[model samples]
Target: MRRGLKITLVAVTGAALTLSASACGGKKADSDDGGGGDKKSLKIGLAFDIGGRGDQSFNDSAAAGLDRAKKNLNVQTEEISAKPDEPDADKESRLRLMANKGYNPVIGVGFAYTTAIIKVAKDFPNTKFLVVDADQCKVEGANVSGACFSEEQGSYLVGAAAALKSKSGTIGFIGGVNVPLIQKFFAGYQAGAKAAKPGIKVLPPKYLTQPPNFNGFKDTGLGNEAAKGQLDQDADVIYHAAGGAGIGVIKTVGQAGKWAIGVDSDQYNQPAVAGVKQQILTSMVKHVDLAVYDFVESVANNTFKAGTKQYDLKNDGVGYAPSGGNVDDIKARLEELKAKIVSGEIQVPTKV
Candidate 1:
């Protein structure tokens, strides 16, 4: 089984129920109770990226928001995951299925859904569609919203931390895919590392895979190999934007008694990687949870609107995680750089 397309209905109380019967193509079902009849009856649908909820990174961060919304906002939710080799048509079908089943505020959790969202949002004019990490749906649609983040801004902070903490002057960067988005991480990281330590040696950026080869986002074997290669070159600290693949990178770094920087979520707090928690210097915390929660809350409060919503360092949408207290000594310096970035004094590059 792919374990990707499983439709799980999350009850308001945080328990997940497998829906044996679905309305559209045997994949999803709407909750009947509607939050114990006290709160607004809203059905929110989420389509996750390749790694799904257990990735302990990107998808898990989005799940955090959905779970929080269910508990605090009293809403029902249906969640589905994307297959590894899923095509654009499959993504469109997933979103269409959610909208057809009366799931309002259908949210797509990755940039891969940009095309699907643009296509599906047109058919269902009533249901709101939100796309995270992408701004493709920010056009003239009344029911579409793009939740975009300045990932480079947060990556810069962690890069500075990596430079400050590295015992060996050389640090490495591991990116999931060779796409512009991942490159943005590289650009900021390189800039921040150099800015923090003028002579810091940032090894050439290495990506697990390129476009059309998205396995980089979920391939632990590749992540391990990449991290090991950098370590062999005497790199003491490593930062990764490789989604679930980052687990392998972190593990390898930890076992070698080296520092690692996590991405998307606070990997230090993740139980899945508890053994390596001590090695995680800090994480580039992109608040996908906050964005997802805000969108759900907007729909519930009848304040939903279309267009682009930016979450950047200035607005606390992106930040560095204070994990393991590894960066405590350099906290003041990091904050100074952050303030400069926010004030436009330090321009974080989005391209390598």
Candidate 2:
């Protein structure tokens, strides 16, 4: 189930419930409980991507960081989900709402919020802003920080795993959207597959949706259709970078007795796709959780740095998962490749 605390203006009782729930972490800035007078607590607000808090992938990773901050750092948090095809104005308003409500270090979870973060950060000089995935927000020395990742490097490892495990010698890639960001995943996968097997047939990738139509990230039917089409063409292994929709790809691949590579969080351990655990070979684990945690921790310590913070394989920020033991036999070989990539012996392309 997707779990989150909601705040609304019309529902006073609901808002009160949110505050009460938040109190579980710590006392809000406005609370007066007798033992202390208006105990101050760090307030964090996050704006999630289309899949929201529990899509079992990207958004869930960010939510995990927030949960950690609430427990380990005793901070209060509020998260809002984006609507399908929402306008940029909506995102700007969401960031403004959090800033106006005195929430410091407000975060925009996906690259979709890049423009909104840059625009909103200018108005609230006191508020710190973070945007994940898009490192191009060049507001040097400003209050905005971009938590960037080397997604292509991680995708390369999983692609090698897929090629190593495939029996049909043919593998495929399924992307959620046809944007440059998702394309990075395909590029790395293609390179890694070829590096592992010279004769391996990495079929042309399939993208479920293009820009302005991001339903591909959340639509299960599209995932199913894309995976089935690839399997029909004799592709025995498939990798998906489709957020919540990737669940559908895994389910279909498992039922067909083929292999499915997961993205973002470790899919082999995800409860939403637990029934198909054995079918998942490995996942391109992106440490979005670490990025969110570090950013919040910096604020709590009063040493927040503005600009871009990059996470890559060298820093243990991204790699392939070993869950389900599906990749145990070939892990040593994967490690060798990982070492080479980290040492600059191999250059994983960010573009296909």
Candidate 3:
């Protein structure tokens, strides 16, 4: 748990400054048309996780942000699909490639790139690096910004929804990793469920962490299996914090003739397994797209900042997904619970 302490640095111009690597120039980075700048072209590079694109979870959400960086920020962007074991290889290779090739700013997705970003950032001190969901990587280089989302805050609302909607007294949560971020989601959901139903029996399943496989994030089959186990135990609904793995939870719920919740983005509309198109009760959303796009824009304008920047329910960064599965009654209850939480009437559990 190496955390970089906040340091103050002077910019030589006698300007009192923070030691962090905050982008100084206000110049924006856009590359929409042909070649980025009237002066020079801007390029952006991305490294996807092991599940790559089809997982329909974290990687997909990150890709959506990268798409925004391309279209809105107008930066020529390239993505490298990372496999289970070699996820960081893409980050290392692409970071060096982009810096060496004169790319203004490069983006690395997921925690797998934490060490890679630090190593590459040192090699190319001139190029800027933005790492998403890497709050732990706080190296004091003059060119790095860390991005993360408050997943727990969003999970609380969905927990409330699940509790209210479950005809059975049982509901469950399956997580990809047992880290703070994912565990926080489970905790908040448990709190929400308790708040709504007073004594909701929620099953917490461990999809990863015991074995500690990097590919657990992409294990759709494993996710489904875990969710199925919960459903078989009579859980009416299941909430999933697995990345691409959540797709399996979605499938299990739909196929088993039960219900499930989604994370990151809206899973209700995405086409998954057989006939489970809309089985998702609702999704707990963390707007990683908005955060990633904002970082790209910031880097282009040369005003990116470091340190822990939190995106929570208040910032619209995290919340319950819209009820696309026609759970109007559940949505109403969720909204009510959301209001209560924000108003300090309820504290979503965020710890074991």
Score every model by TM-score.
0.90, 0.91, 0.83
Considering every candidate listed, which one attains the maximal TM-score? 2
lDDT tens per residue, model 2, 25-130: 3333333231344335677888889888889999999989888886676466778788777788888877887898898989999899999889999899999888
The model with the greater TM-score, 1 or 3, is 1
The better-scoring model by lDDT among 1 and 2 is 1
The residue-by-residue lDDT of candidate 1 on 188-229, one tens digit each, is 999899899989999999999987778999999999999999
lDDT of 3 by residue, 106-167 (tens): 77777767788888988887778877788453544668777776676788788888888888
Order the candidate numbers by lDDT, best to worst: 1, 2, 3
Runs with alpha carbons beyond 4 Å of true place in candidate 1: 1-39, 135-140
Candidate 2 CA-lDDT value: 0.85
**For candidate 3, what's the RMSD?**
10.4
lDDT of each: 0.86, 0.85, 0.71
